[model samples]
Target: MSDTPQDSRRRYSAPVVDGVNKSAGRAMLRAVGFTDDDFRKPQVGIASTWSQVTPCNSHIDELAEVACQGADQAGGKGVIFNTITISDGIANGTEGMKYSLVSREVIADSIETVAACEGFDGLVAIGGCDKNMPGCLMGMARLNRPSVFVYGGTILPGDGHTDIVSVFEAVGAHAKGELSLIEVKQIEETAIPGPGACGGMYTANTMASAIEALGMSLPGSSAQNAVSNDKRADCAAAGAAVLELLAQDIKPSDIMTRAAFENAITLVIALGGSTNAVLHLIAMANTVGVALTLEDFTRLGKGVPVLADLRPSGHYMMSELVAIGGIQPLMKTLLEAGLLHGECLTVTGQTLADNLAGVAPYAAGQDIIRPLDNPIKPESHLRILYGNLAPEGAVAKITGKEGTRFAGTARVFGSEEEAQARILDGTVVAGDVLVIRYEGPRGGPGMREMLSPTSAIMGRGLGNDVALITDGRFSGGSHGFVVGHITPEAFDGGPLALVQDGDPIVIDAVADRIELQVDDQELERRRRAWQQPPPRYRRGVLAKYARTVSSASTGAVTDLPDTD
Candidate 1:
């Protein structure tokens, strides 16, 4: 609100860096390498979610240095900082995985704490894990400061094509006597070649691309390889871009409008992105006070087509798509076709149309990204279904490879571990709908992803023949006939807790309903007798989250009501 850019820049940072009265702040800054010249420039916090926990973020230290260089070169004093991260891959299928989703809130809180206390004028946040991208965006939205988000970049596939998804499926094959233990061991060894996110349209890449679509990241920044010069260049550009954001006072909320969120959702549909995006986008939008509901995603997906033939449900990897150029070409196709809103604001201080004005489409004969005339799927691969089972809503990825409808007898498991034990033991067979309840947000107390069970089903050659429904969620690498995020969760006494073995369940994508085919009278009787279970955790962060977190349909956020 100041008259001059310099005055506005000092509105926050000057309290710590510019005043003689605040000598203690300057002393602390001097201890950390801040000089007189540095004190004269606007302080920009460079937050890096770098850790050796997983390959996804291991390489971000070098990128942080690149960002500092960018900021210093652009006349801003960049101070690099670190935050906590957890490896979803390392913790998958274990009790520890309960902390994966919890890490998102911690990251946002810590980043906000550092910025607010340090009194930085702007921010450049870099994240690589499944949760880090959205966490950073949430912090930025809350801060409402000039900011830019940078993706660390997607990882390369092992042995050129097969990756961690292959390794997960290999365990199922070994269980079914389709793959030798030696071969499965080899797959585990070569699945991850180096540092980056799981090399597919998994959660990391999905959120990365989604952030770009949200106009928080630089153009074409989501698809570059993690170890490439282009990724470094993009990181540097983001650092410089944040200074521009500060100069123009272009805050994230300025670019993150309702139409902008729609543009991001449209891109997710085209990419056949992860179901987690539905949850994360809602939480992020809620930070900036945007009303993003499951119905909104369902409506926006109606006009978009699944044009990218990338992994999990498709036959391509992110690396392959990168070889033929990245998301820009595909975005250009959607923008020109009028599927995307071209007038939406971007991080570049230009309209989406301005960014795409000189962009080119994917080269001819590149089967990685299909043509507009002949798309992989006419409608979005992601679907939201509601019925007796999920009155609030549930997410399903129907890639068209898995038919539009599935009707089968339910095989109930009260927990994911129980379901996995049965699935790996060959007890889960075809023509069955596996029900894993009591694993939703308040149920599992974190709503773990079922990658192990889903991969096992695929490896056993039953990916298309069977279906799995859960109140929890799935990894981005999970495919086949699957439905997740059922609400209200079983712990809160939704219909899922009432499901018994042999009950006929139907998941009809064509009708957009996931139903439990029992009489209304019987359902009412069961509900009368059903009782909520005791809390799985009675202490610590997970317990706190279980207590405060809301339904999955509302983004599983822990914030107070928005009635304000």
Candidate 2:
């Protein structure tokens, strides 16, 4: 009395394959290696974000094939599809970086479009870069399918503990005369050794860990090396796990609950993850129909502490952490400390507590993750701040080493390019608060990450001396006294637009406020004078994104209610 094959697994596939009216569809699938036996099986879409455009995702083609093999072995039909990916490392400072965040929307749209069009019942998305991870999750959430996300895995460290950030900082070092052009060239040549995401707890690794904690990815999936046997094994297991998920009828909606998102936030805090986690997590939650907000980060961050000493703020790379058992042990530690929700459902078809029950603790003499009693920071380094300058709130990564307070004169620039020029030429010096505006979601039409300028600031030896506030955002590798995702971005005439050169800007992390020290009357006068700039791109993806994207405070998603 077991369920028949058609009754058991062919919920969506039967309609596409079993009906005579759908002969064309079956015939087309047959050309792609679909047999009569394959027609009876459930279809699992394998979304591959593989390209040679960057080392971050160059190896994903192999991982996608492994996943397809896994599905085929597990009595499911696997169909592979390709999605577009943009390299943040390659696009960091130029106008091309404007497409970086836009690529997330494109990836999500493509995945959802293909899966739905082809009637995929379950999904396995393989992603390597920062946006690819979230884009996959968002697509799966929108589909409400039994989906599994696989991190493309952290890259191996470059020579000399270097990475993409090292290369970026080296450029600044050369500009500052700290290093010769040859030294900069040496770092640029050696920093990216092979295919994988940038080798740090940067956005790629950060989002991977966040997705796992959110229960959308397999345990230990975030910690493996991109080219290793373990990553291949993980990809295969993820494909097979989708069939198990389909059997249990557990979809992303069942896993990406509000409490589950809290677990993600908790882990993100404990690991000292990227500030991009703030933007991407909120966007993922929105896609899943979960009620998450910037304030949630503030609330969850108060109790959680930063334990990982990973770069760009600390001494180690994700590979080193992986060497000591990845984040599994750290997750177990957080679970025991009562910081994580033990009952949250994960992709394993078990509670998060169940997954951690068998996880062994980190080996002795490991300093990668600090003991809870003596944490890297007593609370989360990701501080959500609010004031006149950012009435809708902003995010700051203050590891306490930068001091909790910064009061300086504003060195205003209309764009990141302008700021970078000044910083490279030494026109931007210590105690100057660099205000790079009009680079927000609508303004930049993509909300670009400010890694180059921030790296330059650090490279110029002004890491602790200067501060940067941007309406745009920062890379996971960006550190120092930096604040980003300032709401009501300058394009929308937020307070960031009213500021002029020499204006006093105060960032108080201790109190969680960023104030522009101008009287209301004077601000109103400047506001009256401010004029909204013409759209940067008259037509194309950037223009469309500018037309539809929401505020950064609301995750900068494109599908929100049109308030305009």
Candidate 3:
């Protein structure tokens, strides 16, 4: 009930300090012959994932200042540093993109190394893009330090009405000949204006929100707009919150519990979040020694309906979601419905129940976030399917499609380029299972998003009829009968490698199956003669990725030992 800022002073306060010489702080303790007085102060490390190349996180330079300000305000010494920034949109084709998935582990490894050397008591992670957020989470999860995640919020909506359209709509317009190349360029330029724009929700926003909902961030910190002044205030608040976490001895492992993960799942589904959230959340849960499988996602999603009608899934943008009420209102709705675990503790030392008490009631009528009784979707929009083709498992967004039953003759495309050629030539058929090969982890090294072919199929007026299956990943913005993350990708000699043209394939979502109608004997015969695709990279990171990356079922992380 204490709203006074002074109330936070005792719990969140840090000790005041006399300024130390820069040279003295930088000198190695052993080299400088440091005394007990120097070592007594707790050191805070600010790990920022920012690069000029990463447009989403370009503003982090300014964001870092707010974090430092908070640490200083809390009477702690803050040392800010930078790390690798991976952009999925920019590194689309090259081998550098494949490195994006594994880069999280690398960043985490680097953080652990740096923390060891610097001897910091806690850490503040500034991650705004897709890989950066998960990478930071993975690092903090392993380090098990008093840490907090500060996300650069979503970008403001664009000016043009066409620019305000969902990502899929903009892409669809370009494909359907409704938008010219010149217009598409303009939209692309304006759609993502510097740091914090519409693209924020695409992958970055989803993962950042996931971080908060998991209780890793201060409540209400995840949904702020990136370019707004409020973002700076939130950053400072997060910096102060980290110090409070240190005082409470609250570590990342303490907050990211099984129930916390369940809360994240609820939030993700309610937001109509990115499918990549599944991979990142599973990886994160694993870091805490919690087993979270795709089935768990299916089960949790079934009871939790899609409540937020945000971009790629619905009409409004994330900025609107924040202005209306932010995660506070969403969590309030979930708690009132008894959908959230009220006992969960956040970084602020407040229980989820207490946090809900602070949020104002949602306005009477806002179509942006639907209520529990009246959701955007009746059940969880995400579902996992299994069959001979995807025995381990494959995921599909049930809400992204129309008809549940699809039977088609497989139209095999050995590469994405080949698939594009067929679609552009108008040679693709309606009843076709467009099997894309050599694009999975071992195949393409990067496991590129499957937009090229999916966009083409939708453009040809064959979206409803076509079923695009790949041992690769897809953008969360993509919709339709697309099956992604097929395990044991073709280059790795999985069954998908043997699939040939004219083979019958059936996709039955209601039954949760993706079956290849070909006989076992024929498939076995074809599999025996199938030659593995040559290495995509003879040297460099792609070569390393092909050697170390795990299958899609395993979150596509590098198969490195957990030494940290």
Candidate 4:
């Protein structure tokens, strides 16, 4: 008979500890609490994305212990390891933000290195921040190991606002003399109540839910308070879940399939999730050789309603949705609408339908997640626009509340700082498309999130009037009439590099187009004259990244093992 998943010969760690020649390896492990009995069982790696940089991941260390405990209780040997993390919230708008997206690759690489070198049979990656979720999932998929992901959960927003994005918009309002310095200071003081990712349906929460919908995490693992017992239980449960997956020989590739990605896209759009979902999901799918692209987003997202009434585009907070019994109710709704691929396999070794079984419906009168008929938008909030301005394509996140069409004069800035300065000095006026260029993956050396300028525009009460476009990307918290991820980036002489001050630009989200009024000859001449800037860093991690990273259109992933 074929060897069962529980057979000793089937475990990846068997050779590392079972033989006499490997006694030294077992001895070192024994120093740290491993026993001969433990050596006989599975070695499940606990990959924790924990750091003191932000409250988002402050609790993961303890959660890792909880996972270890759960693994030990389940008759497996849990070995804890850590990967690097950078705080996007702490880094936003500054040079520090350059490392935010770059850290995703680092996290994934580190996890794969540790897991493979350590001979772990299975993995449980505990993540809290925005990039960490996708980073962990990418590593898990790359290793093709039996793995499970655990989300640390969302932060509790204090009395002042729902999330850090609120404080960002408040800074804009404060600069425009709308709010006094005292009010802005007050918001900054108490915006984050405790540990977790930035509140709202931002990148962190978005990817967490997307991973769950993609079947990496356990059911109902996406929504919950960071410090709650429920989150603690989920972390522990993830520990046990990976073991179960190993018992069934169910690996990440078994679950991270094309159908699963489409379901994830459906969930992202249905929850009104981050535009980063497009980039990160593409990256994760690429790791597994899945053919997910921007066109897949456009095709799958059609007629998929933005049903969640959550921020940064809508009225409620993530906490409000959590109050309605978490994402299960929402997923259940999608399954009922036939919007989800219910037959896909999850880490549970069961179909998505099996995991979602017995999930209770939302309580009546909860407006957090809207009903299908009365959606936040009749279609997904995200759009991919095409025209002379973005011939390779660009991403526009339309919350339905933002302006449908805008004809504007281009106010060009070569860097984010320059754009922020102009906005703060009140130089940015209505009918201006603030163009920030040369900040794509290779150009910026790390495509930074454009949260500061976008928030300032909203705070200045010019959200509907002013529009911004960049070769870079945005924080999930960013809203308003903004376009980003302009491919064939400015560094590569993209159309964004040709934009001059006073150049007429028109963005029509309703028509799904962005047109530069300049004729082809003018654009061709500007492109010919354009010179690619010298590399910013001659050596170091950032330099390596800029050299290897691809465009944001293809997820900006740098660690493709099979790539040319």
Candidate 5:
């Protein structure tokens, strides 16, 4: 690929000789058939999160090529580099999930290190799936470079009649005995076959859209299908956008302002985004020296109505969302309602208002995205709860039901296995608060999703009437009044560690509180006697994870620095 006349002019106008090491730029230019004069051209770094194991991002290799074409066309040098790819499925039953959360920090650190070492003037982050997007953003925040995210986009809908179902639906059917063992296996296989359909608005799609709404990704890039030609075009455009960003000297710090973070939060709730987003966003915000807390999520949830009727919370998929118009259209809806931060800047060097032009009519025809006047839900689909149970805070996605406040006796289960066995045996009752503890960051170390237990409880026909409370995390596809990521987890002698079987518990989604009926004195006494479990692992990643991983409220990122 060669630079176009317009690209050459843009490069010539900016002259990338700012911030970067002039000597390093000259050395790289010499190696790439450029002279001292060409050293003035913008240098763009392509931080690619592609690995053999992460199928969701396996296509990033080709996407990087597309980005390179754009970079060259824009008269900039694009250096492609690799980072760690963490797959949630392959990490089941281990501390891999915890490690995966920390992978974002590692990835961000890696990108920063590479950019500093190579003296690249700008960055194009090619990320897909859960952790990579946030990881890239965190790194970019520190570097404050002219950077943009290129999401690999979600997978296409599945092939079979049943295969096309969302992750929640598929899991629900299997749990309810509607699908046989062989059929369930087939559905799972077909649903996540390679580059797409990696579940619903779970972590992957949620992170992608959140980043897009945060102004880190190109507008309309969040909903493209991974294999579609549009995604390739978006990648190419992202490549060109980086060069433009460099020329304009617009760094991530310029775009990722407080208003942009708020916009991202509003979009997260309106879209019924993943519970994991709450954690990741906080971590990303912190990287930029911004103060974001669980309270912020609660406040935003109350004002932002649920508009996107997508899976886990609703009936559509990302591909369907794309067909109806993607983030651009959704932003238009928010903008029209006066809900968006109109002045926020985007990677395209235009105000959010400018980028949203003509998107309203396109969204009007698509029912997937509802207008603000008639939203799917009146407020944010998520809530932050607090009380003796969650002193710091816990999150719950309350969308499908109304009047869900209830006080019930606790049915405490120390492990997921016990909870599953009891639910399957019909031991659960209506108005019971199912408390599963010792599954938090320090508890499970991996902080595994409590999907199986939550689904089993629902399958036993006790979903609505019964409330599920845990110190663990829940999948984005999971619905119901399930409380997750209770800080100061049971393993660390939090209030959850003091709950006894048959104790009364209360969950008031409207009041935003989760409380154990036991008095504070009794809870304190129980906490005094609580004993921590023996260490699950003596060495390796598990031990390191246990030692360094923070709570979910902090993005569950590792406390250690990236050595490489």
Candidate 6:
């Protein structure tokens, strides 16, 4: 597709390494092990999100090496680069968690900065955690280059089928005297056994599956174990696939179409993925200039069913799903059922249906993925509710197990720590709707996930009884009757900011509404008296994020039109 004749693969690289005028650039690259022959080949930037801050990304360094090898073998000169990854699991409840969503923006910016500066002809971004996955997609879409994303893969379950969620809940269990100190310590020590993303179908797995379904990743790339040979193969294949994509001039814009996004939404709904998918998918779509909104999710959810019985609300983990032949088989089922767009192009240089052509169905009698007719929820478990409480919209994950409707007296808290403390103690009980506000994108300056408090609620045995509504987001691992991503965040004087203790709140998933049971005049009166809190951080990235991040309803993206 490019007119450059100096080695066809060197479309972008030729300008940087071919001419005599570019000797300085070439000289710098030479110091990094670039040979004369390597300079003539296409450059493939492997954006590696390898960090020891979390186990999720700890193994990605080796995966990056595998990808680079594949690129070299495919006749492209591979250049490895690093990006930052913050641990949402470790930062969930503390002030440090405010950097969680902010990290997504930072990751995207860094990847774009590196790729653009290097003038790489293609990219293979490897992400292991929740934020970095979407961040990778966003960066690739920005570059509009021949790119492939590789998931670091899901972690294996620990002893007794426990995970990070088990550890958070164990703390609450210990607080409630349901588990001894030794028992809690045992769970804390064993929940995270080794490297990989969270074991369940949390945000990491959800985003990986969504990206694969969006045609940005290779088939089965979303379903391999972190330490498995399959994952290494996936990384290598992604690297090789980018060369094919470069040859065909198939950029991310060509693959990340509206139809492709619809396929992604369908698969995510069917898989019972995280509500964070709504945020990340919208963000990714926005980056690619695709018009996706919360309403699109509502439209798609009407037909898509929750089939995968895995995750925080379900019975299994991603490892179990991987053992049962991954998501390819399920995709085949969806395609046959007319739920997926068969014509959508993918990184494989083939249509989505073509990729799934030979994918075998899940083995007979596997309960991991329920049949369509006997689906886990019959429709999507993700409900986007709008009411006085959420003037724009709010996301709620209702698996029917948590029931579709909840009405309770408000138990207000200003932050996650407050709510978490109340939940751990005997303060938060049944018939309570925990209103956790001032924790949205701009409000929290990072839109922290409320995994700790929600896990605590479950551990305290009030999951079925209590509900939490927040302007902040929830972790994919946080279930129960919880609503998050309330728009016009509390910091901006959203309705959530006006809520007070003992006020009645009703969340009706069937009606798709989250209402405050108060008179309009009273709400207006309270709004008139409400005062916006001072910025939590006076300087640094958090302060900058607070000043620039958009509302949760708009994907919480920073580069959008006027972060306000």
* Cα lDDT of model 3 by residue, 56-86, tens digit: 7889888988997787588655668788877
Q: Each candidate's root-mean-square deviation in Å?
A: 1.7, 1.6, 5.3, 1.9, 4.5, 1.7
Q: Can you write out model 6's per-residue Cα lDDT over 69-179, one digit (the tens) per residue?
A: 999999888999999999999988999999999999999999999989888999999999999999999999999999999999999999999999999898888888899
Tens-digit per-residue lDDT, 8-57, candidate 2: 66677777777678889889988989888888888999999999998889
- Per-prediction TM-score to the true structure, in the order listed: 0.98, 0.98, 0.89, 0.98, 0.88, 0.98
lDDT of each: 0.89, 0.93, 0.74, 0.88, 0.76, 0.92
| lDDT per residue as tens, model 4, 161-280 | 647987888889988988999999888888888898888999999999999999998987898888899988988888888778877789999999999999899999999999999999
The TM-score of candidate 2 is 0.98
* TM-score of candidate 3 on Cα atoms, chains taken together: 0.89
The per-prediction tally of clashing pairs is 2, 0, 3, 1, 3, 0
Candidate 6, residue 487: the lDDT equals: 87
The best-first sequence of candidates by lDDT reads: 2, 6, 1, 4, 5, 3
* lDDT (Cα, tens digit) per residue for candidate 1, span 459-532: 99998889999999999999999999999899999999999899999999978999999999999999999999
Q: What is the lDDT of residue 564 in candidate 1?
A: 60
lDDT of 5 by residue, 134-163 (tens): 888888887888888988888776655222
lDDT at 286, model 6: 91
Backbone clashes (count) for model 2: 0
Model 4 vs. true fold: TM: 0.98
Model 3 lDDT at residue 58: 84
Runs in model 4 deviating more than 4 A are 1-10, 561-564
